[model samples]
Target: MHQERLTKLRNASPAVLPSLLQCDFGDLRSEVERLQAAGIRALHLDVMDGHFVPNLTYGMPIVAGLRKLTDLPLDVHLMISDPAAYVDDFAAAGADMLTFHIEAVPEPAQLIQQIHSHGIVAGVALNPQTPMEALSGCLDQVDAVLVMSVNAGFGGQAFDPEAVQRLQQLRQSHPELLLEVDGGIKPETIGPCHQAGCDLFVVGSAIFGQDDYAAAVRQLRDAL
Candidate 1:
């Protein structure tokens, strides 16, 4: 697919991405359909293993189940110990974008190439302590960079506003990279990240836990 396809897929103002995360598997189809109607073009799936992030989330069964939900693109974050071990599994599970922690595998660039070989976009994530300098040479190899502004194991944590400056420096160093901020994103916090050059912002509890999901999505979109 063309790179521009991502920009054209959603109707949100400012052309920013609002990726829904920590979603209820029971109501996924309806939730996805509602997001589609609400002008969302992508969903962020947080995958974790007990060792990597102190939490165990979903695997093949749930990922496969979600593949049936919608046509909107899926952004799969692998918070596992050995992400490279399951690259093809995630591709087979229908992930449009496969993201893994930069600290996971021995070779970040090669695994990214492996994902792209599967014909899916590849992404690398940075934990609260992982520096962008670690991604130095491979910056061009990954399609996106996910910066976890809050610790990964929990939700509803406060946004680390300092991430805005940290991400800005990284964005300045690699302007073409697709920057995504995951964790504690609300209408108030996202604008600062946007100004700091984040292209996509991931929000979980702020959207799904709200009484009105679509309205929340719209508010985030408008705020961006």
Candidate 2:
């Protein structure tokens, strides 16, 4: 069921995935409901373990709780080291699609296979500084590729213009695969990312930081 929905989202160019990182946890359920009502197809959950990205974000318990809150797909991004150890846990916790950093995992194919074995979609992420070659020989093994437009540790950072070129390169090579761009995705920057062939745009402050969340989402959706 989730895979079919994901396929539709992948084909629907410029799908906006609001990052829950900027939302107020005190009102998380409402925030998620609001985004869904505003036409968001998926939620991008960033799981950071201070060791990998110098930031400690939410864990699997939060994911388990969120799973019961909304029916939207939980696209969990593991920006932590030793992702292999936690793939089973995140999958059990209700992550519909689990994306781990290529830099963190010694063998990405093994991790992708592990995620698939758990009955969920798998994706690989490349940090802004990480070269495209890192994803070579492995694109066919994963469901998607997350192109980080800014450093992964923190939120509210500026988008790196170089990501545009990377997106173009990946799109050219894997034309049918899902290509997502995260970090610093706003109304102004989304157009450039979309032009670079990014179909999934993971937005943070641009949506949650606004008083009119639905309107903010509409602005991004219309931008594409």
Candidate 3:
């Protein structure tokens, strides 16, 4: 891991990453390259297991394939039942940072340690309805906090207003934490999140759904 790049990413005015869920997976490499050219430093890969979340999405195989294509850091968000069972595999698959749902794991500290043991950054995620209490005693245990602005398991859903309060709480309490807001993040919602102190923004369809990737990314950056 390059500490400088990680530091730059964390300290960036606001890091905007376009989620690959809305991309054309048939030509994933080209799409990722396009995103890179558009000034994206990291890629957000949402890993969903049919049981934890309603939908099933990408896994280690696709992550590994993506690793072979881009040099950008891979931020793999694991929305699965037993994340502990597969952290090492995802790390081996070239994940630069691994985030698992607090709703899925009981002892977040142990899982955080497990993820760090693989020499990758560890993050904890909270769904829209899940309380911050679920993150008790573990706020200091992870590298980032992924605040799901919409229900998990799907992309392009509308932003939930309750997430703004959640972001406020996390920001006020952990000012140094790498705060990230995902789901339904667009030019309209990014401002609220940025004002709430979120530095890492994940834009899905708002960027990938467009004809010009660079222009879309510029709009997101300009909003911040």
Q: What TM-score, over all chains together, does every model reach?
A: 0.90, 0.95, 0.95
> Which 10 residues in a row give candidate 3 its minimum summed lDDT?
1-10
Winner by lDDT between candidate 3 and candidate 2: 2
Q: Give a tens-digit lDDT track for model 1, residues 1-224.
A: 52543343222223434444456667877877777777776777788898988888777766677788776677788889898899888888888778888777636777877887887877788778776677776787887788889887776678888789877987888887777888888889989998998877888777877778779888887888
Best by lDDT: 2
- lDDT of all predictions: 0.75, 0.87, 0.86
Model 3, range 1-224, lDDT digits (tens) per residue? 53444565686648897788878999997998899889888889999999999999979999999999987878898999999999989989998888999888867888888888877888899989887898877898777899999988975578997888888999899887888999889898998899998888988888988999999999988888
RMSD of every candidate to native, in Å, equals: 2.4, 1.5, 1.6
In candidate 2, stretches whose alpha carbon ends up further than 4 angstroms from where it belongs are 1-5
- Across residues 1-224, which tens digit of lDDT does each residue of candidate 2 receive? 44775675675556899888889899888888888889888888999999999999899998999999987778899999988899889988998888999888746878888888887878889898887898896898888899999998976688899999998998999987789999888988999889988888999889988999889999997887
Query: Which parts of model 1 are misplaced by more than 4 Å?
Result: 1-21
Task: Give the C-alpha miss distance for residue 156 in model 1, angstroms.
Answer: 3.3
Runs in model 3 with CA error above 4 Å?
1-8
lDDT of candidate 2 at residue 171, scale 0 to 100: 90
The residue-level lDDT of candidate 3 at 183 comes to 87
